[model samples]
Target: MINTHTNAQDLSSWQQKYPGVSEITTDYSEHYQISINKNNQLVITQDNYEESMIITDKGTGFSAVESIVFSDLFRIKSYEAYTLNNVNGRQKKTEVAHIADKKLDRQSVFDSDVKLKTFNFANLTTGSKKVLKYEMEFIDPFLLHRFMFATSAVNEKRTLKISYPETVKIDYKLFNIDKNNLEIQTETKKGITTITFQKQNPVVVKQDSEAAGIMYEAPHLHFWISEYQTKNQTHPVLGSIDKLYAYYHTFISKINQTENQELKNFTLDLIKDCKTNEEKVKTIFKWVQKNIKYVAFESGYEGFIPREAALVYERKFGDCKDMASIITEMAKYANVPNVNFTWIGTRELPYTYQQLPAPAIDNHMIATYINNNELIYLDATNATVPFGLPSSFIQGKEALIAQGNSYIISLVPEVKSNLNTIHDKIELSLIDKKIVGKGTFDANGLAAAQYRSIIGDNLLKRKDFAFALLEKGNNKFKLIDFKEIDFDNSEKPYSIDYNFELDNYLVNSGNETYLNLTLDKPYQNDSFEPTRSQTFDHEFLQKKSYQVVLEIPSGHSVTYLPESTTFSNDLLAYQFSYSQENSKVYLNYDVEVKQTLIKPKQFALWNESLKKLKENYLETIIIKQHEKN
Candidate 1:
């Protein structure tokens, strides 16, 4: 039983006093108590608790939460000196602090008005057990660095025994406020709300591990328990309009004045440097990116605007907000055009800005404007990236532009999702029964970008990487010419075309070996315990065209060739074919991920398809021993 009518004043309060408070531990276990009751409800109970930070902002009447666990990624790797599955620990004092203030204004807590104190958690363990306890304590609210803090206790083996709900509902209202620049909405719902967000297949969820470390990232998250009364009761709305207005005036005024003088002086001086408006804009853009390094250190008020453009210029370092402010001020100084700051999110969290509210969308970055007609998105931190192009993360999201007393919402460019295509063409001459060939490879879409980001600025390494794609092969290889397409230009489809040569793919007699390319990186079979039972299934759409042309040595006859194969299940389909014409062997393969996401019930089918693809890539052809001419 839970108490539903307890008010703030009625809650337990002892000043949270601790005498020697050096160490504490907690053990929590969750069990599916009920699934699909007569009222079509789902219930699960988690017996978990420890020292955790709770945000209670009067400005927005809503509270944010973050719980620190002993086995989390940061403490495990940073302090314990652990790598992967390995675990280690060191002796240190734990600190605890608290802050009850306004709604969240920025992600970090550099200039925040929060209280601080220290506690201890020197006694912790690394071994596995069904029930384990870890101690956690509050820290200055402004000290939190990431967007959210989540527990890492889940793995691939966790049990999810609850039944599905027929429908899910959500209700959101003004939870807290921090003027126009910042606000927090209280969102609550009964029934299964997570199911409503499922994609067509639901399998896509399984592709990326929500666990601690993997590519294709998303932010930390916090969820609270629900306690309701038998009947609904109307709640009063909370507001702090006076405080919000006062804070906004001071913060905005400080940011503007700090950068104003510098902009006026710079604009006057740049007048003599650039004869054309276009050159001037380009020059300024280059200067901002080259000079600024995005290092966010938000303690308290520093989270608002930067210290000022002059201070940023002298320091040569600032966070995303600071970089945006510097560029915005410089534009004014140069008398180029109007530039505005905007917010955006990366593709990791797929939320439609038009459909979802503003707060759910973006966490970082700003944009520049031209004559109030054209808009350009700039992220000075990505120095190597070309202008007009943001990292794949910011593509296709909503951006909020500051307008007088209000804010306007705008849509960023839509990201093009396409099937992956990898083509490999190799030509080789057999000397002493050793196969040699020059190869050209091509790829596109997200797959291409993933590969290019890994290839970096090395040509030899790129060729070697391609050869490594031929994972299991007994051969010495040499790569010749590798030509890859432009990866940074967002306007162009992601493409990679490279050329390479390989040697020693055949035995002394005439036997030949072939290599298969299947799910690499994120999908590789690495072992990790799962915390949630509902594993997400995903489908990968791919096509490959490899044309291998080889000439028979002296007097030789064709003895064998690979048999063509095709496979299709309810979730996916794949086809592989090989042809021999004259003295050349042509191989063609195509795989289509018909569905986007999958549910737990379909994991077996998805797993089978992946297994078949891996086997097909390993198929080889052999030629019978021939007489020497």
Candidate 2:
């Protein structure tokens, strides 16, 4: 039993104290009790409490909606909600009249047993308090739950308690906890151990513009049952990395790898004309990448189990696990050696299997092929990614490759900035009252792949996409004509040639003409917020080069030229240079970002670099008319 009264008077007092808080959490508590039942099964009982008060006049008459998700592994034992109102120093209570529980189809690709419980409290006026209480019983102790202390509202106090029998061993990890405000206590009695954690005036949850994931900044607890003893028998759960791998192996081992006749024949047909084993493997990989559609289904056991390769072949659609299975089997059929089923986490997750030996550590699956002592990771989810390049989201993440009796952990290599390059070459000249130019844009590596994906097969939208990519200067710039060359050829660089005109780009004041030669400043406004606490994630290394040749008209001569500028640091570098040769004024700009992550501590340096970059963009090239000879 936990405190349910929100105390409307206390909420009013808090309103005066805090001033502008939209809502305040009055009470938030959780208790979990774990024990071994007579049937030798581990059982967990959960008690939860949540209460909040609306403080501001802007928050009055707002509807409150609460939702909870559960599956067959857990059952809700009890649920109740109530509202308290303070009017003229009197307290009035109203119980919730309606609640709805319905099964949710998170994805249409597969069947799921997950359900969502939702209810609404309407007509919540100022100084109103709402409370919700629920209890759940876990049918499977292996499926543990996570508790987060910070939320959208300001939390005044939060308490968590866990009690377990002495015979059962549990492991817990605390993340992002503020040691200055957290309190812990432990007590043992009657062969039972209990641990309590309490915190007051916890930091309110604020969205960090630089954070890659909210979980990286929020305080939370992750605990799991490791081992238990019941009826003179000891059972091991997730006690170590080996045990975790073994448990995951159970799911992978169950996937039938026998290549059916259709799959074998199809794979053989795809590789029959290939010259080498590498080419054969790539042929099969590309076949699957272009054919199979990815449909993820994460409900109960369906999340871990991979459908048979033959079944997936028939359906032509499956989740990441299913895709991995089909690709692995197909490669084996093609006589490709060292084909491995690998588990990896995307950029959204910050944990590794060694740190947290649980399913939460990894959320994606791919096939790794070892050829000539080199590893080639393949993911069929993105049809645009070329061979030998890992998906951008999994770069630098750990890969848990499944071996026959053991597993190997390897780090995925990060793609170099030089490999993904964007080069722009333009020649500009003043025509009439507008600046007109003919330019060519070239992209290679991941840049090319990304452009191809964005352009897709819609022939009508290619010009529009090219215009959007080449947009520069101001809104008055327009694309007059464009042509895409080698865009469809993946082996070659994606190139686009376009001629554009900018209206009123050259301002004529008396004898001087002004032009801002900086066509595009991509990172001019990329400064991070000063108060951000989490590291910002950069998707990939990038290198950009721009060269502009301004052909001086017969009657014009350069009078004032912006000085060259260069900025460099370990993380990033930029160079802008201007020169004149005979009748051509050449401008070259180059930028390179060497790292894929910008830490919070590096924000100051990054901001300073941005400031310099913005200043360079503002420099203008002034030309004077030849005094009308």
| Candidate No. with top lDDT | 2
**Regions of model 2 farther than 4 Å from truth:** 2-9, 59-62, 86-92, 102-112, 178-180, 454-462, 486-491
| Model 1: per-residue Cα lDDT over 1-629, one tens digit each | 11123233321221132122222112222221222335433333222222211112122221122232321111211111110111233223222223222433455433433332212322222211111222222221111222211133212121111112223122222121112422222322464322111011011123344321211222222121122222243211112222222323344445655445655676567555788665666666667766676676544445555557777777888877788777767776777665755556554444444433333344576655654465666667655444554444565556666543445666666323243555655555556645555555556554464565576558657657765664223445454455545655432444434444344555443343333222122232522233333434232234444555666554555566667898987666677777777765566666655543344456666777777766776666554445555
Best by TM-score: 2
Candidate 1 ranges with C-alpha deviation above 4 Å: 1-150, 153-287, 330-338, 346-362, 368-376, 410-414, 417-425, 440-554, 557-582, 588-609, 621-629
lDDT, candidates in the order shown? 0.43, 0.82
lDDT of 2: 0.82
Quote each prediction's TM-score. Answer: 0.52, 0.93
How many clashes show up per model? 41, 0
Q: Candidate 1 at residue 97, lDDT?
A: 29
Model 1's TM-score against the true structure:
0.52
